[model samples]
Target: MRRVALLAVAAPLLLVACSGDSDKGITVRAAQVATVSEIVDAPATVTARAMATVTSPADGRVASLLVKDGEGVNAGTVLAVVDSPSAQQRLAQARQAAAATSTGAVRIPRVNLAGTQAQTDGAAAAAFAQSQAAIAQIPDPAARARAQTQLAASRAQYAATQAQARDAVRQFDAGLAGLGTALRSLTAAQGVQAQAAVAAAQATVAALTLRSPIKGTVQLGGTSAGASGNLSDLLGSLPGGGAGAAGAAGAAGAAGGAGTPAPSAAGGAAGAATPSLITPGALVGQGTAVATIIDVSALGLQADVDETDILLVKPGVRAKVELDAVPGATYEAAVAAVDLSPTTSSRGGVSYHVRLTLGAGRDTAGAVVATPRPGMSAVAHLLVRTARDAVAVRASAVVRVGSRNAVWVVQGGTARQRYVTVGTQGEDLVAILAGVRAGERVVVTGAERVHAGQKL
Candidate 1:
């Protein structure tokens, strides 16, 4: 009887020890109402609002390097001058063509028809007869009538020519050697072509004198628009008509594409050569980079958000930015745009470009931060999802119960599985919508070790 009684007391003590040990291995927290946010991180780059690139309009040698690199310039300011022999030659050719075609008035000599009038009249009659026969063959009555009228007019013109010739011969017979008949003047099309060629040539020469298209600092290199091919401009400079060549490649996207219409500051330059290379007499091709003007009045950012998180991001979404150069500073920004086109990330993951307008920022000391220059690297944490004052639990507490999410709640020393409708998920907290309640204790640290009705 004494042995059995000692066993009974020991069993209760062992049960208390087991419960204490189980509780020691797990951590539980009372659920409370809190704000939960889902942040999507993205890689970003700073860029300028606009950039202007000045290019060599023609293949030529750098005649004069006007402004130094890094010098601020105004729009229309002459940055450099290129001496293109080809452009000068084209101008000269255009000028000479214009001079030759100065007057579109043309005259054909009228031969004396004193002895030839009879022959000319006979030939005219024969031609009219033959033409009339052909006109008769036209089945359409309206067409035949039109042809007959045209044939009669032609015959009348021939007779007029004979009369003019006869008159000229009489004048010659009267001893007036300079008296002769004049034919109709030529077309004015030649004149128009001449003017067009001259204007185009002049424009081409003017382009060689590179001017700043925008007010910005002059970089060593620039970008250009693609091949300039104008049919009228081309035809105007022919032996009598064709004139100048086309200009190619527009200034593109980082500062410079496939990249962006407004490039990042680092991307716009094709290549920057040393100041010496661009000195007088250096040769460059048509559309070659001569200089780039960066407009940094407004700053923006481009970030590549992963495809998985892109759906959560939209215009006007709030974000916080951090730059490597401006350490300890947090920049406030909002999504200005989200690109429809996707770009492949370095890890081969699909991502999209998201643009944001950087707003005011503060350093750790709470002072207003200065604007970051273009081409700076940055990271943005986008507040894509948020839940305000919702019942929430530690993220570790929520466990995947197959298709649904659930949390282990401690009730009267027993753990119970409460299936939840999860909402906004933050880094460390998860919003529980349906199953979980505020003030309820949930197993957080060791949720995986808990079973239904498990003692805590």
Candidate 2:
């Protein structure tokens, strides 16, 4: 019975070995001579070379919008007008104070004793002296009496004149003192304060008018208060004075004043020129962005490279850029910059920003291609290393054996373990420096199942 059981097990084992599924063979591929390149691919974005945001200098209502979105504008172009009543009032007060202080007489008064009062006093003294001398020379009682009376009259008149001269001198001195005080006041701290007020008022006035700081296309920006018809449609209607129709309604809303809702929040008509965020009567605070100007003539690509591959990228390295917007077209580019600092992704991976400059390329007929716009999605392939006509094999065909690398070569339905010295390992291919020749079949998968000298 034991012998019978052994025979039964051996018969089943023999049949199982002859079955089609019993053969565990490995897949093999021949090594080929081709160019292998080590490249790092990263997502990129097309961006403008320069961009600027125009902001409100102070809190105020937007009185007028001079440029619409997508409109071409030059540097210093008027973008919008802000109506700041408070600032205007402040400026008016400052100007009034300046004018009041600047319009007064600035000349210094001169005080001297050579005036009519001094002349009159001198003449009176001389006359009185002469009269006294004549009286003393007179003789006879009647004549002397008459002369005495005349002398008395002359003395009284001289006394009155002297009093008048003293009064005149006092008045002249008082006037000089007053003039000096006035001259000192003009050059004193009050004068400097007036000048400062005027300068501040001028600056406030300038702050009310927003202007484009760069030459480029304008993009309207601000906090949206309410929904209007299409935002773009409202901007388009500005050149046709459609905003005036909305202004009438806004004025009605403004009549409610302070506590009432903003007029812009009460949606306007279908064709009004009021901006989605800022309208004619809308209030904006200082430093609020009013518009954006982007210089689109020159564009570049911004890519984020993984931390592991960042060291392989450097300035002036050649790159190939493919844009999603312009499908099937590849452009030549060069690395312009790389951020030394790294940034962390949401998933905790580290990355570094790399900037590239796009170059103009020609087509097969040598025609210049169209330039890509800003904000387009792009992919950049940075060439790290390249080997021309190199003996290369799939990376999976090589396995790490202790410290060195080895591959399983299959010949005549048998496997042989061979050591390979690899120069550069790419994403899918590895360049072999030795121990592997072109057109040799190497086992790529299932190498663990086969040993050296194992038959397939």
Candidate 3:
């Protein structure tokens, strides 16, 4: 009887100890009302608002470089001068030809049909008069009769000659008209040729002097081709058309090689040379880029978003950007554009390019921060949705039970599993629409350590 009483007392004490241990082992926090936002994160690259590339207008030796790299310049600034003796000579010749054409001294030989007709008429009259005199000189009685007949025949011959002279005059007039038309045509053609030559020469001369088309910093060098010791040397060394010529080879390869052929390295080299096509002394061909000018007044970010998440991104959406170069700085941004078309990777994954405009940002103390430069690596978090003043809990506190979302609620120092309907889910918090109320203590961490109806 004594042993049984002691056992019952010990069992009650052991039960109390077990309950206290369960409560001590688990962690719980009160659910709170707060705002939650859904965001999509993407890696991004910084770029300038505008970029201008200046290319060589013609094949020539660089005579002088007026601007250095990173030098600020205005539009129409003379950046470099190229010298082509051949081009200069051509221009001079063209100018002379144009001057000659503009003057009226040049004329086609004119035909005088009226003067020729007058000469023909005079000859015909003289022949007829001579024939009449010769007939009068022949006089013997029978011979006189023969002279009279001959005189009649001479008269008839003179009349026929007169008609032939009129026909010759008409033919001469028609020939003269055709000759005038030909001369006019020749004159017009000469004038057109002169004008065209002058225009072409002027263009060539202007191309020899490189000018900046935009107001920005001057980045010296020709596109992808390494700078030569001098412009002449560069031009002489590179193949005609420089690196741009490789494009044709690449195209041919694509057409004949079933798309499996790699692009020519020469083409890539040409592209790299584009920014620095012509140095102070390097030679470059026409249409080859000599420098690139970047406008940095406005900065933007370019990022590739996964195809799955692209649909949620659209213009005008608010975003937050963080630069890799400027740690601890966050810039406010907006989605400026989202590409409708997607780019496919070698692995067959598709991604769309997204552009964002960076706005002014402030530090934790509310002071303005420095603007990021182009080419900076960055990350952006775009806000997709937001829920205001919603009942929410730490994401860890919510657990999936079967098909329903549930949370472990602590009431009377014990955990109770309750099903909750979730709304928008954020990175760290989830909005609750049902089952859980604000200020309710929920098991956030160590929830797996406790079961339903267990002490928390």
Candidate 4:
């Protein structure tokens, strides 16, 4: 019984020894398992896709550029009109001349050179008659012999007459060929002139009526429409016309193939009330652009980065964009292009333009919900680091001395200082290269105070 009592007492003491120290100020928690990521931030700017300089076609006064910059336009829509009274008058005259000279108006067919050939034949005949008359004279005993000689001469003259007739026939043939060619050429020229006159008249009339060549928001400028206001509002409120309808349809159709038809005209108009091509009374000039209509159905982002960061960007690289205007929202984008040439800021600094195409991701959906503006500031994070299941520890927990990294690890009721190789680091963690293993206890607390083989 005494031996059993001694055994019981020894078991308690052994349990205490195995349990080590009691709970104290130091608290231990499991290291968080997470994938580490890093980002490089660069400043950027946004710009329009294209900018055009509108000019006038003819030398005329600034009759006015009806639309202001940033206005929308449509194809075949008249943007501006240049007042050219002289040009209009000239066109009218040309039209009249063309109508007079057109087919069925006045066409003349002259006799072919065959008639000229007939006159040459008559001349040849007269010369032959004179030769015969001369040969008939001359008769003496010596004259009689001479008369016989004269008769021979007349016969030779008759042969020459036959040769002349053949020459006349050849000349007539050539003259007829030339006449045919000339007639055809003249007819073609007259036809061209007639068509040109008609075209000139039509073009002159067209110049007077400036219409929208593209469907877009119109800005009143060069010439005012008697009222001044935001260009976008005016375009939205303008009446319907063929030009306007086409523009609206095009814009809506481009917004993803689902679009509503523009409102139709109600009152007196032929076939269909064509929407007004442009706002009525809007002033325009020769070749002056009146509107800048953009199809915002799909939107993308453009960024200007420093030359140093350009190399890191490539087409298809994944990126996240946070717009300054859209707080707490990020848009998913992909690298579309890396432009080597300078895109923005003409100043002495080196910069390149990078285009980011927004993708149909959650971030992009957020952008649509937030509706970021065109020029809004955005920060992009290009994913460059990728690693999986790497062992890591807080960088702060590992103290670097010279070329070696040291961390205190707990073992056998004591703290041990271990020198380790760190492969990578993060804001809160460092990858332990060779000195640590998963699920091992480390001195996260009291790390700075612990010494090698020190008792806890």
lDDT over C-alpha atoms for residue 260 of model 1: 10
lDDT (tens digit, per residue) of candidate 4 on 1-456? 000000111112222211223354343222333344434454443333332222222223334455554456653455555554433444455456545545445343455434443443453344334323322221111322443354355345534544543454455466634444433334333433333333323333333434443344444332232223344443442223123211111211111100111111111011111222234444323333333333333456666666655665688877777766656666777777777677544466777767776543334344454555334566777654433355555555687667888876667767777788775445555556688764445655546665677675
Of the pair 1 and 4, which is ahead by lDDT?
1
Q: What are the C-alpha RMSDs, in order, of all predicted structures? A: 19.1, 27.9, 26.5, 27.3
- Give per-residue CA lDDT, model 1, range 170-273, as digits (tens): 66667764443322211122333333344444555655666775667777654324222333432332222223332100000000000012223422223223
Which ten-residue region of model 2 has the weakest summed lDDT? Answer: 1-10
lDDT of each: 0.61, 0.58, 0.58, 0.43
TM-score of each: 0.63, 0.56, 0.54, 0.41
Question: Candidate 1: which stretches are off by over 4 Å?
Answer: 1-25, 94-202, 222-276, 368-370
Candidate 1 residue 115 C-alpha distance from true site, Å = 41
What tens-digit string does per-residue lDDT give for candidate 2 at 1-456? 000000111122222211111356566777767667777888778877666655554446689988887899987787888776644555565556546546663233344533443543443344344334423322122333554564465455545545544554465576633443333432232333433333433444554566665677876763233223354543442323223211111111111111111111101111112354755665565444566666776678888888888988889888887877666677898898898989885357998888888877545565766787766688898876677677777777889899999998877867899999997667677889999987677876676676888765
Best by lDDT: 1
TM-score of 4: 0.41
Q: Which candidate is the best by TM-score?
A: 1
lDDT for residue 46 in candidate 2, whole number 0-100: 80
Candidate with the larger lDDT of 1 and 2 = 1
